[model samples]
Target: MNADTPMIDTTAMQRIGGQLGTNPAGIFQDGNGRRYYVKTLESPAHARNELIAAKLYQLAGAPTLTYINTKAPEQIATEWVELDKKCIAHLSESERKQAQQWFAVHAWTANWDAAGFNGDNQGVVNGKVLTLDVGGALAFRAQGDPKGKAFGIRVDELDVLRSDDGNPHAIKLFADMNADDIKQAIMVVVQIPDEKMRRVIIDNGGSHALAEKMIARKADMAGR
Candidate 1:
């Protein structure tokens, strides 16, 4: 874990709102009085996927909510944001373009939850578009089941990308990303230490074949 990542202390956390997905989450103050939204996960797969997604986004220089792992409740704490809007209507043309480009990170990670109800999973913080809730990434299905049905849009789906009524901008944005952009994003994943990466996969009950498949998929995407 990075030294700067915020680990949750249950005694210091307090529930502030409704649950997020199957996890019960809420706002909490850290030892330093900093506030964060913490979501608890019962599944080891969710935890592992969350951590890996966060690290990949950070390494790729993309905007995502910062997350820290916790023990007791098996939770992850993300930086809190207030007063976020869904549609890109509020963003300037330049910001919209940047947001479109930044969405390449999602394509790289295969996050199907990128666009929530009215863009609930994405928001503008400090005048920048930041992607949130990447727990739905990497794996083939919603539960991160390798043999499960594919959940999100595959990287190769171009036509259906713009068909989303909820947040067509997301699909359109991702569709605009070229192979090099995706390759650049996946390059960061390739840079992670093999031991560390393998440990995360093994600890999460992921098989060696699954890991190899993930790597191979990224490599194939880079080549296309």
Candidate 2:
């Protein structure tokens, strides 16, 4: 569903999975039997941040869980799609082929945690690669884009690839992808207008101030 959809109440969502993280977050099944990983964000702004990131992922056509608009401002939910236990580095070469879009999406959002030595946020499902968690993305990188170089990738004294900013080791997964596809993914976000972004925030229980922040962040990414 789009961001303009109404927020759903958690009252009817039955707990299905075990409690996770330090918080009381859980996997819940809605009345329709759709499961979602629901968690209370650190703050309302963070909730909006996650929402924006989810939308960006959706816009890029990244294979990811669907972000839900919970009625609680500090809470968020993502529709769960079962994936194999393999982590980022363990993905087979074939599964990695379509990973470029999400990688570019991560860079534009400054999701350093998705890369680096920590890569559990992603895995494979039926041979298709997808990222699972991106709660910490969307910090926004304004300096370098269009060329999309904010991190370096090197091998045998040769620079092979560069991202907006991720660990050289972790982000190299994107190196073998079609550059045009990655650029197109980044452009999907860059093309969103301010009014639409504001509507997205307001429709999702985010404050006007939060919408303003997202607008500024979007402008920064676009201006670059």
Off by over 4 Å in 1: 1-6, 19-23, 83-89, 140-154, 157-160, 163-169, 172-210
Each prediction's RMSD over C-alphas, in Å, is: 4.4, 7.3
Q: Give lDDT tens digits, candidate 1, residues 1-224.
A: 46565557867566556655545777876666677777767566666667776665665667788776576545677776673554555656666656665454565566665654344566677777777677766763334455254533235422234455555655645555566655554465455555664555565556776555555545554555
Model 2, 100-194: lDDT tens per residue?
55555565555554543455666777777776766655542221122134322211111122443445645566655565765575576667777
- Scored by TM-score, the top model is 1
Consecutive 10-residue window with the lowest summed lDDT within model 2: 151-160
Regions more than 4 Å wrong, model 2: 3-6, 19-24, 140-169, 175-224
Model 1 TM-score? 0.71
lDDT score of residue 16 within candidate 2? 79
What TM-score fits each model?
0.71, 0.64
lDDT of 2 at 204: 54
